[model samples]
Target: MTLNRRIFMIQSLLGTVSLTVGDQAHTEIPVLFEDDSQARNLGYKEDSRKVDTAKFPKYSAGQKCAECQWFKALPEGSTGTCGVFSGKRVNRNGWCKSFVHKE
Candidate 1:
């Protein structure tokens, strides 16, 4: 192959490899928090975008995410199931009245 053609091929191969690596690095883990009777009873919905402590009377300052029984601290981030929810990812910054300290 000519010098120009060889260089072009090499560049193309490198681009493809870089794209593959980037795609693999971005794999997303599904959020573990879902709708639960506990959340529902507390006025929290599965589709709720966020926990509004101001609007929700159940939310209190003592009931922060870190204190929750289900809060799992991972290297990447904290995620875990809520007592009310069967399976879902609650934010580490989340708070609810049902929050219980994990032993």
Candidate 2:
């Protein structure tokens, strides 16, 4: 095995591995709040404070999707999948009428 040949093989393997990891990391970003009709009807916001308190009296301060019962998974980002959103990403600090207390 020549030195150059060994290095080339190692580099090829690394490149393939990196590509696979990158693709897996971002398969398909779930729909955003404004893109989904259900979220829109419920007054979903990326920031809970942006919710119209006058129209949605149920929304209170400090209520976020991450803390809601409907939230399925909240990775380390501001976006997350919720039961109500159905393949859409809701805000960690977002609020909607569907928000429920997490038991």
Candidate 3:
């Protein structure tokens, strides 16, 4: 192949590779409580660290985000507005003792 043709072929190959890789780019999900101002205002602390539910009285069974009345599963995943809070996306894994089943 001629020098110019070889360079053009290489560039075309590189562009195809880039396009293929770009299609697989993953979007990162934002942290729920990057800023705990809302949690703090509600008199609750944002704790991402997992705790032993069996040993913890606060982490009772049937008090999960999925079971909560406010839970609304979006196309992305489970996110919802808390009954306690007017408007906020409660974590799908979040839990509280006051969780109530949606009718």
Candidate 4:
């Protein structure tokens, strides 16, 4: 079988990145802080109860990162990965304007 040129180039690039990053790629993802600029921009609150409804009119009483479609909780923590904040963990109880309820 002949290798497609595009596929070969993609594979080579991925291999290079994997080798270059090595173990560093597996290092723990940092937790997103409430004061983080990205979080502030999105109005993220570590505790859903602490959200200022008057400031964020879109937020509802029950919304949280754990309930958002973009969140993926780790097996053993109160934090999870969020699509809104790539490479960082958000508190499961966190609230952000970007929240989209999981179906």
Candidate 5:
């Protein structure tokens, strides 16, 4: 009886730990990096101010992800989901060629 109880308890502990780790992995959205292939193609800059205007003439001062139509601001943190980057989070101050004013 004692051995059975110990086995059950150990299994329960392992199950709980596994669930917690899995939940965290699923719930966390990965942050988009400027060096990412897709990001580089789109001229994504983590900070709009860092964007190279000579290379991307369409970019203008004050343009940022937070003000763009593709961005969905999260309840917490400076990072938010961008329609341009599926399953990835972008900095609120980030900029990309896909930017469009949120009307």
Candidate 6:
């Protein structure tokens, strides 16, 4: 076999293994800190009930990240990714101004 062919086959195998292993060992998303700039801007609170009612009058007692359209619900944790904050995670019970009800 050519040297280039061997290299390609090895790379493909490594890529496949990486993906498989990654899927089996999914890491929990870290909880978003309320102090985070974006969180602050969105008035995100770890507990939706704690959201500043004065600042965000639209927020209701029942609003939650787990039910928000922007939230990417994690399979096994109380934290998940939000479309508004790409790299950071938000608590499933958290609330933010940008929340939209999931259809």
State the lDDT at 73 in candidate 6. 73
In terms of TM-score, which candidate is strongest? Answer: 6
Please rank every candidate by TM-score, starting with the best: 6, 5, 4, 2, 3, 1
| Residue-wise C-alpha lDDT for candidate 5, range 3-96, written one tens digit per residue | 6988999999999999889757534989999999999999999999999999999999999999999998875769888999989999999999
User: What TM-score against the true fold does each predicted structure earn?
Assistant: 0.41, 0.68, 0.43, 0.73, 0.74, 0.74
Regions of candidate 3 where Cα sits further than 4 Å from its true position? 1-58
Number of clashes in every candidate structure? Answer: 6, 0, 0, 0, 0, 0
Query: How far in Å is the alpha carbon of 17 misplaced in model 1?
Result: 22
Off by over 4 Å in 5: 1-27
- Please provide, for model 2 over 1-103, each residue's C-alpha lDDT reduced to its tens digit, 9 standing for 90 to 100: 5669889999999999998887666347565756477777888888887888899999888888889988866555756777887766677777889889899
Stretches of candidate 6 off by over 4 Å are 1-16, 24-30
Q: How do the residues 17-46 of candidate 6 rate in per-residue lDDT, one tens digit apiece?
A: 999887654364456799988788878899
How many times do residue backbones clash in model 1? 6
How far is each candidate from the true structure, as Cα RMSD in Å?
A: 9.0, 5.5, 10.1, 6.1, 6.2, 4.3
Tens digit of per-residue lDDT, candidate 4, span 1-103: 7899999999999999988787454247898998899999999999999999999999999899999999998856688889999999889999999999999
Quote the positional error of residue 71 for candidate 6 in Å.
0.7
* Candidate 1 local lDDT, 1-103, one digit each (tens): 5669889999999999999887554234355333555555655433333667577866654455656675664445655445544445565666655666777
Give lDDT: candidate 2, residue 86. 74
Which clashing pairs does model 2 show? none
Candidate 2 achieves a global lDDT of 0.78
Residue pair clashes in candidate 5: none
